[model samples]
Target: MDNANTWFDYIPFNSRGKVGKISVLLLLIAVGLSDFVSASILKPYFERLRPSHSELEGLILLVNKGGKYGFVSSHAANIFAASTILSFFYIHKKKLCLTIAFLVSYSRIYVGVHFPGDVIFGGMLGYLIAIITITFYSKFVLNKNKKKLIG
Candidate 1:
């Protein structure tokens, strides 16, 4: 348990390193863009309502933002996407990245604004997208510049 807690503790300070800080910033930007595109634009088009506003009234009403249509959670999507990209870049600190990701995703539920299912699905989707994006960028873009950096 102590070992587990240690990893979580490291997450908040992982960006202390110059390279790690740069990686974190890049991941944050990528995640933010993805979340904005999905939640702000896509959700409106889909027009799905929140669980609380749905016909089923028995569910827990976490938050009542007045405006319904809470299909995908922006918080979940952003945090999970950031986590995925950070994990790929900082493979040595994968556990810390995952822990931070989980906490960020959970915040949406704790604060209201998104249903449990919405967060889960959004997180999964964001993670998948991040993985593909990171993999391709690393292979094509970074690989081409590796020699310059090393030399």
Candidate 2:
């Protein structure tokens, strides 16, 4: 197949237009912020121990123990943030994005790294961050530059 005008020609997937490129950049920023909040701020403040570190009688850790704290799983936060932002940009792939985020969050628990509450809170935090970021993008970035992007 001729690859001259393929969709992947841009820096990001399907980002042929300025809006798409901006969306991708915002998505990345959202995910990064989510992970930072979960891993650096909240986790340190809460200081909850990972299941792998706790002495659960029957706990069988699939992976090595994680850091000192696990109040919020960064993996869950990052994935959910990415998924939520992607859903905003690609409405048709919302289900797929959410499913992937759910699976990744669940794995954090299944592997005995995070508790159910950790994953839940992480997902919520991620969703909140994504929403805030997307709203900012829509209001400031997209709205302000609508004419430039469209024209």
Candidate 3:
């Protein structure tokens, strides 16, 4: 497998269905925005610090240290949002996306970038945002033309 392809391999950009394509794009954007809001807004509001910066000791980092605030991890939020949105579109792809999401969230904790609470809250925020995005898309785009790919 090519190294660059590794980053591009998972997303099914050329997949069939208009709704599926639009859903992926919109959901991705929503998740990205959600991550931004959580990282920038909520993190400042919560005023949390990363485990590495805090009083914690003896951490083994698989990756580089992360930003200051660890509450509501952006990785967890974005991945979960992508996973949830993809799951809604293609039932067969649900397990893969969700499994990846969980792994990504766990990796944050393992790398000492976030606590379990941070990962969980971030995932929750992402999931909620995805739900709202899907509902809005369904109401405005899907139902506007009375099209059905999935609910």
Over 1-151, each residue of candidate 2 has an lDDT whose tens digit, in order, gives 3675663652246667876877788788998899889988998898888888888899988998889799888998899889998888778878988999999999999988999999999999999999999899788876888978888
Q: Candidate 1 versus the native: TM-score?
A: 0.70
Clashes, model 3: 0
Highest TM-score: give the candidate number.
3
Models ranked on lDDT = 2, 3, 1
- The prediction achieving the highest lDDT against the true structure is 2
Residue runs of model 2 more than 4 Å from their true location after superposition: 1-14, 146-151
Greater TM-score among 1 and 2 belongs to 2
So what's the TM-score on candidate 3?
0.87
State the lDDT of candidate 1 residue by residue for 71-112, as single tens digits. 787777777888888777778778887888788878777756
1-151 per-residue lDDT for model 3 (tens digits): 5686675566767566876578668777778877887888899999888887788667776777777788889889998888888888877888888999999999889877899999999999888888888888889977967755543
Alpha-carbon shift of residue 111 in model 3 (angstroms): 1.2
TM-score on alpha carbons, each prediction: 0.70, 0.86, 0.87
Q: Weakest 10 consecutive residues, lDDT, candidate 1? A: 8-17
Write down the RMSD of all candidates, one decimal each: 4.9, 4.7, 3.3
What lDDT would each prediction earn against the true structure?
A: 0.73, 0.86, 0.83
Candidate 1 global CA lDDT score: 0.73
